[model samples]
Target: MRFEPRRHTSDDERILPLINVVFLLLIFFMLAGTLSAMDPFEITPPRSASSGEDNPRDIVVLVGADGRLALDGTPVAEADFEAALAAQLTESEGARVRLKADGHADATHVVALMERLRAAGVTRVLLLTIRDEA
Candidate 1:
């Protein structure tokens, strides 16, 4: 009697190529995709006294929730804010500022403030934010 040809059947043989294709797609996406940084939504940073230790001329600019502004804890009027910051910059060796904006503060206002700070010859501006504790 003649023997029929043996047929090889295995589920793994069918799936092996699919697994390789999936892994290749995964690597392709990982390499092609760009990573971006996002701002934290909820995090409180611990209080530290060393924030200004590096620079004696470092000043903190506060932006309140109600559009109020303060330079070094002294409240400043909106119209005079630029002049006040300019004056601080003139007195300091390097124009560096720490911006402490309230969570509820307007985004436009903060950006405007940053622009003003840059226009006023501020070399650097640090945005102080609390660390996420979750």
Candidate 2:
């Protein structure tokens, strides 16, 4: 008596399940990733000795070395900075503003900006600084 041999399945059936699993995993990670602002300009932030703690800021103002001012990554005229800040402060009653200035930024420029923020009724302004590597 002769015995019959079993036939092997096609490659498409084996690969389809693996392809579907990989796509499912990719979709899961894409949905899980954090979505935040991608600031266009680059700035070497100053370092600070203090380890201060505060809640997340509602507005982030960036000051470039060439005296350029940006609010939430959008460029704005120096004259209009205060007005824009005032509008944001009014919308969020007690929200704080954070300032991120380049390392080479002038102290006077920062001070002047702070004064403007204060005039706009922003009492709490936190200066952002990077922690030095040990």
Candidate 3:
């Protein structure tokens, strides 16, 4: 009786393990990476020597250099800003909020924003800034 030798595995079979590993890596990255919503507009945060870090959980208020405003990543018209903010304040558990203002934003505007936040009953407002790399 003559037995035939086994044929070589196809290229597809050879690549199966690589494909599985690549898929596994993709899944791993997807699970391991943290995804967060980006700001509606670009903002260059002011520089500071403080080593404070930002907490992603905090609700953020954004102010652009050109006087644009966004709340929790959604653009809000200047006229509607207070109403929107007050609405959020009532539903929010904490009075804490984060202010992310552009580096070039006017100081008075920022202060006015803080006053507005205070008037709206926000007790703890954290100003976000980038660490100076000097």
Candidate 4:
């Protein structure tokens, strides 16, 4: 009696790699989607006895405790901030700016930023904050 070796069928050979690649792609997209761009730094807004409507479409300017700044969630360099901010608001003449300032961040810096926003032609600038108990 002679021993014979069996060869893999074409169906099995082709399908295995296809299934593996599909799974890999699925996992890749799942992770990529979950790992979207996050804010460069975290901030704790001050509390206030105030309430107002917030438009989700309104632009946000996040100010960190370390004097770091981000425009619409993207970090912006102080040197080019005027140009960058102007570029962002070029279309909207009366763009509403929402300032999210960290509780511990410099008040002077926050004011300065607000001034810059005003200079950039933002007519209405709202300082975002948590509401305190009345």
Task: Using TM-score, give the best candidate's number.
Answer: 2
Q: Write one digit per residue (lDDT tens) for candidate 2, span 1-134.
A: 99899889999988999999999999999877846665657878898776666566568899998879998788889888878877777777788888889999999999998998887788788898998765
Give the per-residue lDDT of model 4 (tens digit) for 1-134.
Answer: 99799976888887999999999999999998986557779989999998899776677889999999898899998988888788878755556888999999999999998888887788888998999986
Error of 4 at 2 (Å): 30
Better of 2 and 4 by lDDT: 4
Each prediction's TM-score versus the true structure: 0.57, 0.73, 0.72, 0.70
Question: What lDDT does candidate 4 reach at residue 1?
Answer: 94
List the global CA lDDT of all models: 0.76, 0.84, 0.90, 0.86
lDDT of 3 at 65: 96
TM-score-based ranking, best first? 2, 3, 4, 1
Candidate 2 achieves a global lDDT of: 0.84
Tell me the tens digit of each residue's lDDT in model 1 across 60-84. Answer: 7888777788887678999999888
Prediction 2 TM-score vs. true: 0.73
Output candidate 4 Cα RMSD: 5.0
Q: Which candidate do you rate higher for lDDT, 1 or 3? A: 3
* C-alpha lDDT of candidate 3 relative to the true structure: 0.90
Pairs clashing within candidate 4: none
Which regions of candidate 4 fall more than 4 Å away from where they truly are? 1-37
Q: Which candidate is the best by lDDT?
A: 3
